[model samples]
Target: MNKMAKILLVALLAVVVASCGGRKKLQENPGVSAEIGDTTSGIDPEIQAYMDANGIVDSGRYNLSDPLSNKTIYFEYDSSALDPESDMIVQFHAQHLASTGGSVVLEGHADERGTREYNLALGERRGQTVQAVMSALGASNSDVVSYGEEKPVSAELWQNRRVELLY
Candidate 1:
């Protein structure tokens, strides 16, 4: 191969190897339990008892129709502050965690517009923002992971700049 082709090949190989090193860790959800909550909490008492008997706690009154509960909280370009709507959703999630004594994992992501390192830092900041809110609301066991641009909600750049909450 020519010099440029050899260099490109080596760089591609390095990315593949590095990504492989962390693939297993990402795939393993070691402490995540099975689905344990209903989408809403106003079920009949009989059904609620059945659900509780089966270890499912009601996730409480989050407005799924609300933009905030859409599960993808977006950020402005290069900014990590939660918008008012997203902030409400974070508060709801924090309340659930505080009440149930379960854990939440905030998976931070970024659009594919910036350098990988910058995107990674932005993603981490977004996750940390959620983590701070959760802690302040008494969800002490929250965790944060920055996937940066590695995980995209869509091909659209704006859609990718988000944090996904997982429990």
Candidate 2:
């Protein structure tokens, strides 16, 4: 009946109500259990299969060749702005590097549309952007390298303009 006792009683009632609300929701939606649903369930079926076959779960460590992994961060024509998906990938790898204490090489490449020197500078800039993200996420043991127009993952111009992380 005292102020302190009343406050404690109200707090206990609030906790009980909150706990009961969750229990009722769980009972109503028993099929949506977190243990039953996987994080990779929303990904591409092919990518999911590949991850399963390779024993790679949704642990944030990327499998480069997997389409869902977003390993290679592509740049728009001459822009180095990181895409949301690629930014997530960089953050994931940055966390991995921070925990593992291993060195990573950020290899930057550009399409053959520009002059060799210009492409080299562009590639360097892209690599530096990725390095900056990594540094922000506590990755210090990283190296940036520019392939410029010398290296192209494929004949496609879009594919060429990318920064790949080598761990």
Which has the greatest TM-score?
A: 2
> What is the Cα-based lDDT of residue 78 in candidate 2?
83
Question: lDDT for each of the candidates?
Answer: 0.63, 0.65
Residue-level lDDT tens digits of model 2 in 1-167: 35674345334433432443443343335376552223334554543443454355664433433222344777879877776445545755665566557688999989999799999999989999899978865788999999898988798888899998876
Write candidate 1's Cα lDDT for 1-167 as tens digits.
Answer: 35674345335433432433332232234343232122233443433333344354444433332212345677878999976445545755565567567887888999988899999999999999989878866788978899889888687787888888886
Name the candidate that leads on lDDT. 2
lDDT of 2 at 126: 93
Runs of candidate 1 exceeding 4 Å displacement:
1-69
Clashing pairs in 2: none
Give stretches of model 2 more than 4 Å off.
1-41, 44-70
Where's the lowest-lDDT run of ten residues in candidate 2? 60-69
The alpha-carbon deviation from the true structure for residue 131 of candidate 1, after best TM-score superposition, in angstroms, is: 0.6
lDDT of 1 at 12: 44
| TM-score, every prediction | 0.60, 0.60
